[model samples]
Target: MQKINVLGALLVLGLMVQCKGDKKSVNKVESNAPITEVTESVVDTTPIIIEKPENIKVPDGMVWIPGGEFIQGAVPQDKMAMDHEKPAHKVKVDGFFMDVTEVTNAQFAKFVKETGYVTVAERAIDWEEMKTQVPEGTPKPHDSILQPGSLTFKKTKTSVPNLYDFSQWWNWTIGANWKQPNGPGSTIKGKDNEPVVQVAYEDALAYCEWAGRRLPTEAEWERAARGNKSESIYFWGDDDSILSQKANTWEGEFPVTNNKADGYEQRAKVKSYPPNDFGLYDMAGNVWEWTSDWYNTNYYNELGAVNGPVVNPQGASTPYNPNMPYAKEKVMRGGSFLCNASYCASYRISSRMASSLDSSLEHLGFRTVATVDMLTAN
Candidate 1:
């Protein structure tokens, strides 16, 4: 217990915090619309590609996406777009089988070496399910900050003061799970293709129920991160000028200068870069995935008030974040390596966020999807 302090303020008052558990006491949180970046230069078009499902059968590491319609939310010409990714609505998704990356660390260490399992950051927090997400009594946090850890990102020597003060770089390390990402002696050995960072969303739904597959519906992860490049803003179309050859972001002043310059300063391996026109790969930046929906900052204004195309939305049944509204979020989608276009560019594709299904970080990771009756029931 007790390790969480690289100074993300005491790593969020400690307990390797921000596993979102907090509500009932918020004073004024009613802010959503000012996130508009639109630097105005993107007009490439010509993508409409959608291919895969030609003879069907696709399985192996997985790829097939293909379904149709797009416009999920706010990449209307992304300068960064956000306000819960806005009324850039009209959705629809049905052609499945995804995973061509971001589920590595040797496939979650082979589903924890055949299901011995134990992950929500290596277990141990239940303050009676975290004192019903803090407010009423909220007292129980002392066994040196209640054991088992996860958050881990700590790297700043100059620029902090804001980026919403994510403890200036998140720490809660303890043993920083997913094979010691930066805690303990730190290893993931030869990296084993990176992507399995700390994992929680019920440990990516117990590794998508031991690998049959699930967790993609945020309209199937914005239609496989928009492979058809809908109106394009990147899914290999809107020219971020090949953004570091196609995403692994945070190249400069994020938590005081990443300077990894895309050679990787955190979470890279999953395809290392280059795959979007539907082949999939890291899907945006390197981490921050997990979908099967929920986090509703007004669920895209109720799916942009549904005039049509909202099929397969499975998202806003609950969980809202007027900042916190007491915790329980989900919908995560790409954008990690701390993302930066001067802060949270979220590697573009309608970038959304809101994590906390008992959050886990290091960068966050997920990637799974399937159909054909979930691979014909395995």
Candidate 2:
């Protein structure tokens, strides 16, 4: 058993508090903080944009985003769009290829077998690690590290109006991972075809490296989701009412009652629904895809030229300012199947969310991307 330290417990408590607030106001921050300098120079002169090669054929079920400038934010009418998506800007992305579907359990299983990999959730916490988390004299909290790491949605006895109090639905469960998605009793035996859940950012990174792919940057993900179309509320178009047919989202009352109208109570199979114009499946709703960028609500404000010099925008290396204490969380894009209009309306193309780097959940998964060079080779 590992004891829960006061500091660590307090940190977790604070995160719960922060997550329950109005996302827009909770993420907003002042601009006075000096940006940390990085070694990489911002490319002022837009590198000569290369067109998608004529002979380039992505693997069996992938698409080539013939990357170019696209309006990358929400329109005024979409009350569903979060404030972080404001100040739409034009972003140019180099040509790249992205997976058409999220990584399925079958795909991840292959990677694990080949590498003999163990996910972060499977590792046990040593005394040193436990010491860092538990307060002095506190009894161990039942060996958290040894326990499988994942968030399980717990149905509440009473209907609660506060949708933001995710604690009502989210529980840190033991024995939950890509294999045992729902905790101890669950198994992925027959679900090898479904997208693997309970994967952290690091876990996704390892898979990408093994496959010679990389996580898509925030800008690249936005452009790919749009599929050369102007930014709209939904990936297919501006309509929020088109969810059931276009994507799998929570169809009924969130937390307590899920109508399962989309043919799934939890996550559905990848490509179980239709694909967008780019032939990308499950981009709007399925599992939230991980991005390489660190989250910052005001990242768009620094876009374009500033101070009379060509201002090159860079993603945050750490967490966004307002949420700095929760810096361990990484950015996740493309809302999951659990997302709904009534609770989390983040299923739109440009919407964003995040989770702890070590946190895993059934609603989270990832897609891979290849750079121009890698795409050319393929």
Residue 17 in model 1: shift from native, Å?
A: 9.4
Against the hidden reference, what TM-scores do the models get? 0.33, 0.87
Best by TM-score: 2
Q: Model 1 residue 328 lDDT?
A: 69
Model 2 weakest 10-residue run by lDDT: 1-10
Model 2 lDDT tens row, 1-378: 322222223333434553545756655555763353322324456663447677766666567777575666776667877766776666666777889899999999999999998886665545555445334464445444334456666666767788766666776666677898888898889887688888877889999989989999888788788885574677778766667888878887776777877788777878889887778988887789898877665565554323322222345655654544533556788888788787767778778876656667788899998876786666
Candidate 1, residues 152-176: lDDT per residue as tens digits? 8877898665555466577776667
RMSD to truth, every model = 18.9, 3.9
| Candidate 2: residue 376 lDDT (0-100) | 65
